[model samples]
Target chain A: MELILSIAIGTLTASGVWLLLRPRTFQVIIGLSLLSYAVNLFIFGMGRLRMDAAPILEGAGSDPANYADPVPQALVLTAIVIGFAMTALFLVVLLAARGLTGTDHVDGRER
Target chain B: MGALFDHLIAVPILLPLLAGALMVIVDDRRRPFKIAVNLVSTLTLLIVAITLLMIAGGMTASGDPARTSVYLLGNWPAPFAITLVLDRLSALMLVLTSVLAVAALIFSLARWHRAGPHFHTLFQFLLVGINGAFLTGDLFNLFVFFEVMLAASYGLVLHGSGTARVRAGLHYIAINLSASLLFLIGVALIYGVTGTLNMADLAARVGDASAENRVILEAGAAILGIAFLVKSGMWPLGFWLPTAYTAAAAPVAAIFAIMSKVGVYVVLRLSLLVFGPEAGDSAGFGAHWILVGGMVTIGFGMIGVLASQGLSRIAGYSVLVSSGTLLAVIGYGTAPVISGALYYLVSSTLTISAFFLLIELVERARDAGADVLAVTMEAFGEDEAEDAEEEVGVTIPFTLAVLGASFAGIALLLAGLPPLSGFLAKFAMIHGMFNPTGLGDGLPIGAGTWVLVALLIVSGLAALIAMTRSGISIFWASIERTVPSVRVIEVLPVLGLLGLCLAMTLQGGAVIRYMDETAASLSEPAGYIESVLTAERVARAPSGTPDPAQGADEETEVAP
Candidate 1:
């Protein structure tokens, strides 16, 4: 389980870094999104792969039933929402830049 | 009673939140509405002061023979839901932040019209983030608050129209946005492993991690540290700060004071709660690199301060250097070191912001028409450049005096001079690092001690030279224009800020004592985790939405 997760993480990270290093603003934004996805999944995996166990605790069934940890999931859900807002904000800024200044070099201006 | 107290915990966050909404509604440029904003800001400052006083007073009887106070939010308890967590350290930061906010707002009223778009509104929103960041006990909320401030700040940093401001502002936004993303990633990893976002709770859960898990935790920790280091202007990570800060308007730069502390606050919280001695004892590790990073930061900042020609930029470099000193001390893994770091943070934040405002005043004076003040007198009454509140077109004479005084105080404090709290704080840190019983075992205590001492001396010498250069450039070196003056609304805030900085200096003993108790509280990770996690953990499990604990466990999966 860890091995597959690692490979996925590695692939995502490499691709994201490449995009981030690109010269276009759109590519940078895409890179950031991909990177965030990798980070999110990697973080999720850290809870240690427990499949088929609902996190819900049974009251009378048993004292020590197997269950998934849900804290990271809840937190990551919040993060995903926030990340969307930010990426959208950046995207809008990117569009605004294209409209106002006529260039979308990753640097955003004549540096 | 408890509910009432919890609601009281909401005041700092609530004040700015309501004010931001109100400013957007008020929407007009009338003085009355502005006054209303100022009044609310003043009241907010008072509320912050009250909170700090309450915490300080409570600390006198706390676990330390000194003092302590921690406020959990929403009756949600300490480690579970988002806690206000107002121990002495946070309370102190809160007081400084509010005071600076009020002062800056006061300075902005007449200046607001000059500021272009929705100036007061963005200012209020920025405060919302700062107050939230200082008072929050949850890491996720911290990120949320950070973005809020950064977003508002983007508008404000570019408030007045100019190509330079626009360019500077974009770089600023990009860097902070990147930092914010890193902040989330780090938090996500921590939650996965520890299965909790509650800071106090994370501390408790992380202590017993397996070696492999610890490695994953450390990776998350280091990444998070990198994000904050950028904020604090750490060597490589902070390359963008001096330019961004130096380019902003005086009042705008004044608020940037709170920005650096956000990173320091995270480090302090992580050190005290998540990475305390217990974490070290259990995992056979200590935060050694924090010290090394801090030392390098100070060295780099000093060199930058010397190299920079402009007054505001030099002040900006000083902010970076002081942040480095604080980071290094925190890394020392000694209680006293943390306390010293806290004092340095407070003093440096105040000093650098003062320099920013005064530098603007100086630059404005240079740009002024013939009608302003007498050239030589306004140019550099070295002494009056800071203290006086009366200016022809000049910022207040009293303010100028206070600014000058605070600038001097930075040198005194940053250099760890006698009769200032900075010296006492450094003394405590050094004592702990060198003393056997304090650091006590295979930790490279002797080497760390000498390195820290060297940092102190080098930073001190650099400050001495940097300050003198700033003093001359900001006030003297005739810049071929009439004098700069202050608007009626601006005086009290800058003057008020200088006065508060002085008060802290005067009350140095009390300040350190408060930090001592808070540091002790922070050192005890057991209580923080025990406070937030288990109770919430148990209650949430029954709901079946899957407890966030799984996410916390993910933090562990990344461990090795």
Candidate 2:
């Protein structure tokens, strides 16, 4: 399970980086989103793999070791929201630029 | 009211938020009301800042400052709840935020209002974030503060709504938004690993981590570091700095000057507190790699200075160099070095800001267009004498003198010239390197120390040469043109800025001591951690529960 998650994260990161390097404005935005997701997952995984039960003990038994660290999950939750806000703001700006300049290249000029 | 006063910690942020809300309802055409709010809000900020500074001074003297002051919102205690802490570092930064804010507010009354109605509101809101970022004890709060500042900055950057201003501001926001995304990810990773969001708790916690956990922590740190490096304009990550700074309106640029140091302060604060050997025992952790990054930034900034032709851009480049120098010093990660970095930060901030404000005077006087000097001269020589009816105003005579002083501040004071505060601060740092009476590791005693000494000299000389080139191009060459009539509104702010720079240089002694204390507190993280965790720490295992979670939050607490 750990190995599969690791490959999945790595693949996401690589593709995201490739997109980040592209000249197209839309591609770069997509790349940034992808990269942010990969990073979020990677950080969450750093709490060490957990198979037992959820951290809270409302119904089932709960132990510190048994629960996947909920703290990182909380942090990731905030990151996802902030990331979405930034991406949306940038997307609007990007669209505006496209409308104004008639180009969607990140560098602002047509190749 | 008493409960609110008890939480003196939150006032810096709360005050600005209230002021900004109030200003929007103010009539746009009533210049006096707008100016009045700016003054009162800024003055309140200064008062709170001074009170905070006094509190920090008391803590530093007490030595065992954990007993100092810990306030959580809604009476929530730390660890289980969000915390707000004011130890030596944040308190010191809070003071500076207020000082710079007040200075810029006063200056902007005549400077930025030309842009439009909401200018003062945007300014107050921006301060709300700056002060909040310094005071916040949690990662999420820092991100929130960052947005508040960035959003306001976007409006300020394009405040005049010029085609060029909007274009450059867009690029600036785009880059910053990406950095904000990375910041969020870094925070998430750290939270995932450690349950606590409080910095003091993180400091004590991250150090005790297993190897796998350490990897996670370091990864989080690196991502955050990259984000700040971009903000602070660190070497390769800072290509956006010159164009963005040079592009902004002058008074706007002056306020923005303090913005980059916020990044440098955070990066240094985190490395020394979270990654230091005291916390992690990682020999390579808080090493001199940051210093090398600073050097590259300095070099890049100097190259930009020498290569750039116009005053606006040249001033921008000088600021970049100043950022580089401060980063390099902070990279040293020693108490003495950090103290020196603090002095350099203030001195450079003042000088560069004064110079940028002066640039506007030059721009108006020669009727030089705002973009590039070359473009300005071309347009001026070819255009009708339409602007001939307008005077360049009060700033013309002293523009050269102030510009010279700014370059000198970087060269003399920043490079440690004697009789100047910069020199004294630098002396304290180098002396600490070999201070037999102090806390430094023994310097190379003879040859190695000498080499370090020689390098200092070379770097100083290089900075001087760079400044000399800048001085010649910006003022000396530009002086060959005819002068237009000057105005009073513009000249007063320029003079005021100059006066402040001079005072800092002249009386930099007391300032340096305060700066040193700020540095000392960060170099030894024990005080910061002890203060934040005292309420709950007595319950841990007698043999010792041994936690590194404290280190994570402590490292993140670094204000930028």
Candidate 3:
């Protein structure tokens, strides 16, 4: 499970970085979204790969090691929401840039 | 009253937040009402900040021995929940942020506020984020506040939308978004390694990390440092800063003078608290990088200042130079140098903010092409026709005189000339570096100290040259300039900021004492950690006595 998750993160990050370096504004926006997804997954994986382990405590004095760590899950949720908002904001700004500068390049001019 | 004071630790974050939300419900068309709300809220914040500063500095009658206060969210114990820790350093930053906000808010009242929709809301929210960033004790909470700050900054940067602003805002958003991602990864990695997200807890645990975990922990810290350095406008990562700051509206840019410092503030706080001398294998983990990065940033900023064409860009690059000096001094990592760095931080932030506000007003008097025309005329000799009507000993207009004088004051401040707080700050910093172990210790200074001293002097000289060249063009050389009709509202903020700088200079002894205490507290994080970790939960109503099983259920319920 860790191997698959790590591979997924690495692939997402690599593609994101590639797209991030592209000149087009759309590419950059997509790259940011992909990178955010990779980050969210990485955060989720930070709690360690656990299958079938309940995230909540069973009762008082229950051993916490039996439960999957819920903190990273919470963190990933917050990251996803923030990432969504950022992506939306970035899209609006990209459209504005395109309309105003009459170009889709990140620099706002045709190179 | 004492109980109320206990909650005041949260007000800097909450007041602006509630005010921002309240402003959202008010119709944006009612500019007067919004302005009144903003002014009242910001003024209240200033009072609150001063009170917090007093409390943190132990000036209050009810002073605690630790001189630190922690406000746990939901009245929970410290490590289990998010906390807002208020100490001398955070209190000082709060006061500085509020001061700059008041000035920027007042300046925006003149004309810039009308350029965009929901300007007041964005401005207030920006405060919420900055104040929250200063107060948050949780790493994830810091990330959240950072996003809040960046979100509002994006809107504010694009507030007075122009082609240049949009372009610059695009890059700013893209870079910051990437940095935010880095921040997240770093936080996650640190959490995975340390098993705690709370800063105090992390600090306690960081020292005890297994050898294998220590490497990962250091990597996480290093990554986090990169994120902060980018925000702080350290050289390579901060290439987007000058352009974005230059393109931002004057008031927005003024407030942003503190924004870069936010990065510096976090780096300083975390480096000292989490990775200080106590952090076993990780003690001083990234200090050398910060020192070298800062000096390089200083060199880059000097070049940018000298090479920039516009006053605003010069102001932007000056921000970098200031940040570089602070970072370098922080990297030096002695309590005394840190004290002087704190002083330098406050002085340079105010000066650069005043310079940014002053730049807009100064540029208002000259044509957009005045710089180009001035340069061409300098390159090719002045036209005979233009020289024919050159007036001898002409009297400067009242407005021009005031603007020029303010410009000169800012120039002196930025260039670290004598008789201003800037010079005093640098002098204190150099003195601290020389006498790291107090007077007469005669400790041999390292080669790095010499490099830093040289960089500080050279950066100041660069600022002097840049300001003089631009000042000559704007104030003296322009032939067809009309005196801009400046309003009292706009000018008051600039003067108020400058006056504060003057006050800092005049009251240097007291202020330096405060900064010295703040630095001493920062260097030894024991009190901070104790206050944060052992902060007591507020007592609940007697009727709320709960069973342990029920309490456990409630905890699980709230966990997600």
Candidate 4:
């Protein structure tokens, strides 16, 4: 499970960096989204690949280690939501920029 | 402090948040209503900031220590809940933000508010983010507040949208978004290794990390440093700053003067706290990197300042210089230098903000056609109309006089000329660096310190040259121009900011003493960590050991 998750994050990050370096605004936006996905997955993985364990305490005497860590899960959820808002905001700005500049280049002009 | 006052720690973050949301609900057509709300909220924020400063300065009813105050949300114990820590440093930053925000908002009232929709709401949200970033005791919350700040900044940057603004804003957003991703990854990696996000908790755990985990932890910290350095306008990561700041509206750019400092503040807080002398083998893990990067940043900033064409770009490069000085001085990691840098921080921020606001008003009077021609000539190295008829020299007009005076003041402040806070701040830093008393670490003067000193002086000279050249071209050389119809409201904010800088110079003694104390407190992170981890518990239960809330598995709970 850890191997698979690490590989997924690495792949996502690699693609994100490639796209981010591209000149087109759309490529950068997609890159940001992909990078955010990798970040979110990385955050989720911070909980150490928990499975089949409830985050909540079963009882007062229950061993805390037996339960999954809930903090990173909460953090990742927030990151996901923020990432969504970030992508949406970027898309709007890029579109507006394209309309105004009459080009889709990141620098708003042709090379 | 009483429980009533305990909540005050959170007010700086909450008040602006609620006000921002409420302002969003108000109809944008009612200009008077929006103005009124903004005024009242900003005024209230000012009062709250003063109150917090006073409290942190040791005016608490319970006679609690002045250095650290912790307010745990929902009355939860420290490690488990979101906490707002108010020490002298945080309170000072809060006051600075309020001062800047009030001035910028008032300046915007002159004309800028009409340029965009929900300007007031975005402004308030920006404050919420900045204040929250200052107060947050944990890394995750810092990230969240950073995002909040950046989100509002995106809207604010595009407020008075133009081609230049859109282009600059696009770069700003893209760079900041990438930085934010790195911030998240850094946080995740740190959390994975240290198993805690609370800064105080992390400080405690970081020192105890096994050798295997140390590499991962340092990697995380390095990445985190990169994100912060980018935001702080360090060289190589800061080429976007000059364009973006020049393109932003006057008020937006003014408030943003503090935005980069937020990065500086975080770097100082985290570096000294987590990786300070107490971190054993990891002690001073990234200090040399910071010093080298900072000096490089200063060198680049000086060159950029000298190379820039306009007053706005000059102001932007000045930001880089200021950040570089602070970053490098911080790398020295001495209490006295930091205290001096803290003083410098306030002085430079106010000066640059004043300069940014003053630039627009100064440019307003110039002939638009002449302005474009001058820019084109500057860009293409072409001298045109050199043989044209000469004009008679005359007394500087009312508008030019005001601009000239303000420009001189900004130059004096930026260039660290005598009889101003900037001079005093830089002098204090140099004095602290060479303090014969050697009370702090007493580390012998190194080549790095000498390099920093040289860069500081050179950067000041660069600013002087840049400001003089631009100031001459804008006010003296340009011939065909109508006197800018200056408004009292517009001029007042610039004067107010500059006046504040002057006052800081006048009252340098008291302010430096306070900053010295703040720096002393910051150097000793034990008090901060202890106060944060135990403040709530101590309040609820006097006995320290075996509190029912903290189970035997403190390690387990703190870790995975």
Candidate 5:
């Protein structure tokens, strides 16, 4: 399971980076979104691949090691939300740039 | 009062946040009320900053190295909830931010506040993020505050609607967004290995990690440092800075000066706190790279300065030079150089900010068509009768005289000329570099140190040439110039900032003493670790259980 997850993350990140190097702003935005997803998954996997384990403890006395680590889950959740907001912001700015420059190239012109 | 003092560390982050939220709801048409709110909150921030500085100073003066004020949010214990720790370093950054924010806020009052819908709200939010970044003692919270700072900055950078600003803002946002993703990855890697994200706890754990874990930790730190280096405007990664900063409106650019230093501040804080001498095998992981990168950044910035045609771009590159000097000096990791770097940091930030603000006022009256043509001509090394007719004026206008004098002050300060704090700061660094005490030696300086010293002096000279060329072009070269109708509001902020720089020059002794103490405290992380880790340790002692959830909502009372 760990190996499969690692490979998946690697693939996502590699493709995202490749797309990020594209010239078009739309491709760059998609690339950033892909990269963010990979990062979110990576953060989620930091808790060491829990199987059927609870993130929340029912009682005050439950051992922490018995449950899935909640911190990474929280962190990944925050990352996902922030990533969404950032994507929205980037899309708006890209549209504005496209409107003003009459091109969608990241550098504002097609070479 | 005692309770207020106990909670004072949280106020810097909270005050701006609350005021910003309030400003969002206040009708934009209520301009006076919005202005009143911004003024009151910023002034209050200044007061709180002065108080925090005094508290930090008193703590340092009491000779107790472990006397840091750690505030736990949501009534949680250390390593469990978010903690805000105020040591000498953080307190100093808070004061610096407040001071710069006050100046920028006043300068913006001239016309910039009316530019957009949520200008005041965004400014306050920017402060919230900056203060929070400085004070947060946890890595994830640092990232959160970093996002806050970046988000607010994106808004401010695009505050005024212009084609140049939007284009540059897109690049700025893209670069920073990628950097933020790297920051997340780095944090995740570190958290995966150590099972902790509290900075103090991480510092403790990093020393005891297994070899494999240590390797991962170092990789994470390197990646994290890249994120900061991008923000710090280190040579290659900071190509977007000149364009973005030059294109932004004046007040935003001035406040953005401190924005780059936020990266420097993080690098200094984390490098020392988490990976300092006490980190065993990882004592000085990236010091050499920082030195090399900083030197190259200085070289790049110098070239950029000399090649820059516009005064705004020159000021932008000067920011890069300032970052390079601080980073390079910091890379040395010596107490004396660090102290001097701290002094240089304060003086240069103030001067560069004043210079950015002054550029607009000085260049406002020049004919844009002729100015651009002249710049293009100068760019091609043509120095003939392009504007020779207008250069025959004898009497300088009053506003022109004030501007010329201010320009001269800025040039002297940026170039590190004699009789100013800039010169003093650079001299102290060189002196400390050559004569670092306790090195047991014939000569303590190395080849790398010599290279840094040479770069420092050469960069100063480069700044001198660039400033002289640009100053002549703007003030002296032009003939058909209308005397810029400067307002008192705008002129006062520049004078106030310059006066502060002069004051730093006059009181170099006391300021250097403070910086020396701050640097000394920074060099030893044991005190920071002990203070933070021990804060909530005692509160959980009576329970005698290592239960992570015990103090989830308990306000662990700090001992006075």
Candidate 6:
């Protein structure tokens, strides 16, 4: 499970960084989305890749070892919400830049 | 009164938040009403900030130098809860942010607020974010506040939308978005290694981490430092700052003067609190890189200042110089030097912000064509005829005179010349470097110290030269320019900010003493950790076991 997740994260980050370096605004936005996806997964993995464990306490005095740590899941949830908002904001800004500058290039000018 | 004071730490975050939400519901067409709401909220924030400062200062002066007032959100226990810790440093930053907000909001009243939709709302939300970032003691909460701040900043930067603003805003958002991703990864890595997100608890656990865990922790810290360095406008990572800042509207640009400092503040806080001497294996981790990066940033800023053509761009580069100085000084890592850096932070922020405000007014006198023509004439040595034809002893308009005087004051302050807070800040810093322990005798001054001193002096000289050149072209050579119709409201904020710098110069001793104590408290993290981790949850009535669902609802009710 760890191996699969790590490889997934690495591929997503590598692709995201490559696309981020592209000059087009749309590509950059997509790149940011990919990067955020990778980050979300990474944060999720921080809880140590638990399977078949309750995320919350079953009852008082229950063994915590049988429960998955919920903090990283909560963190990932917040990161996803923030990431969604940021991507939305970036899309609007990208559209605005394209409309105002008459170019989709990141620099807002043709080479 | 005492109970109210306990919750004062939360007010700075909540007040602006409520105001922003309220403004969102108000009709944007009711501009005056919206302005009134913003003004009231900002003024109240200033009052709260000042009261907090006084409380913090009083605490520092009394028995406990490192005493902190912690407010637990949702009445949760310290490590499990989001806490707001108000010590001398956070209080000082809160006051600074409020002061700048007041000036910027007042200045925006002239014209910029009407340039875009939802300006007042965005402004209020920005304050909420900045205040929250300063007050929150949890890392995750800090990230949330940072996002809030950045989100609002994006809207404000693109507020008065133009091709320039949109283009600059594109780069700004992309860079910051990437930085935010880095922040998340770094934070998660640290959490995976340490099992805690509360800063004080993290600090405690960091000291006892195994060697392998220490390596991961340090790596996390370094990544986190990079994220902050990007925000702080450190060398290489901060190339986006000048263009974006120059493109922002005047008031927006002015408020952004504190934005970079947020990064610096976090760096200072974490370096001292988490990785200070108590952290066994990782003591002083990454200090060398910070020092070297800061010096290079100073060099870069000096060149950028010299090369910048527009006054606003120079102001932007000046922000870099200010950030570089503070970072370098903080990296030096002595109590007295850190105190001086704190003073420098205040003085430089005020001066740079005032300069940003002054640039718009000053640029008003010369039209765009004339600005280009003047630069061309100077470049081609064709200004002699204009100089010869200029009339002698032309009476300067009162507005022009005031603008020119303020321009000179900003120049002197930026250049670290005598009789201004800038010079005094540098003087205090140098004095501290010479006497690190307040004793006449200390370790011999090192070569790195000499290099930093030289850089500070040279950076000041570069600023003086750049300002003089820009001033001559705008005020001296542009004699044929019409005086821009200036409003009293517009000019007052600029003068007020400059006057505050002058006040800082006059009250140097008291301010320095305050900074000295603040730095002393920062150098010792034991009290900070003790106060934070030991803060008990609020006591409740003894009853039968409550429903978990009801308990969750109660937590939400107690929030704010």
Best by DockQ: 3
CAPRI grade of model 5: medium
Place model 6 in a CAPRI quality band. Answer: medium
* C-alpha positional error of residue A108 in candidate 3 after TM-score superposition, expressed in Å: 0.4
Listed in order, the DockQ scores are 0.24, 0.34, 0.73, 0.60, 0.61, 0.63
The best candidate by TM-score is 3
Which segments of candidate 3 are over 4 A away from where they belong?
B61-66, B369-397, B544-560
lDDT of 1 by residue, A38-110 (tens): 8778767766678798664544355444887676677668767877877886776566556546677745466
- How does candidate 1 score on lDDT? 0.68
Q: Which stretches of candidate 5 lie over 4 Å from their true place?
A: B59-66, B369-397, B438-444, B536-560
lDDT of 6 by residue, B133-250 (tens): 9999989999999999999999999886767788999899999999999999999989999999999999888889998888888999999899999999999899999999998888
Poorest stretch of ten by lDDT in candidate 4 chain B: B387-396
Q: List CA RMSD, all candidates.
A: 7.8, 7.6, 6.2, 7.1, 7.0, 6.5
Comparing only chain B with the true structure, the TM-scores of all models are: 0.82, 0.82, 0.93, 0.90, 0.90, 0.92
User: Per-residue alpha-carbon lDDT of model 2 for B1-560, expressed as tens digits?
Assistant: 24454568888888889989998887776767878877888898888888777776664344533324567654445766566777667776777677666656666654356454488899999898888888777777787788888878877776654445545766787688778767866776677666556777777788787888788777877887888888999889888888888877777888888889788777876777677666655433634666778777767776676577676777777777777777776765667767766766766676677667666655654555544434423433332244334323354565446545644554564345765555665566567556634666554465544544455545555556665765666567864774533345555555565465467667777777777677767777787777677644222345644333443344545533
Quantify all predictions' global Cα lDDT against the true fold. 0.68, 0.69, 0.89, 0.87, 0.87, 0.89
Interface RMSD of 4: 4.2
TM-score of 2: 0.81
Candidate 3 lDDT by residue in tens digits, B329-431: 8898999899989999999999999999888888866677345333333533334354434323233358888888889999899999999999999999999
**What TM-score does chain A reach in every model?**
0.89, 0.90, 0.96, 0.95, 0.96, 0.98
Candidate 5 global lDDT: 0.87
lDDT pick, better of 1 and 3: 3
Indicate the residue-level lDDT of B377 in model 6: 34
Deviation from native of the Cα of residue B219 in model 6, angstroms: 0.8
- State the DockQ, from 0 to 1, for candidate 2: 0.34
Tens-place lDDT per residue, model 5, A70-100, is 8999999899988999899889899989997
TM-score of chain A, model number 3: 0.96
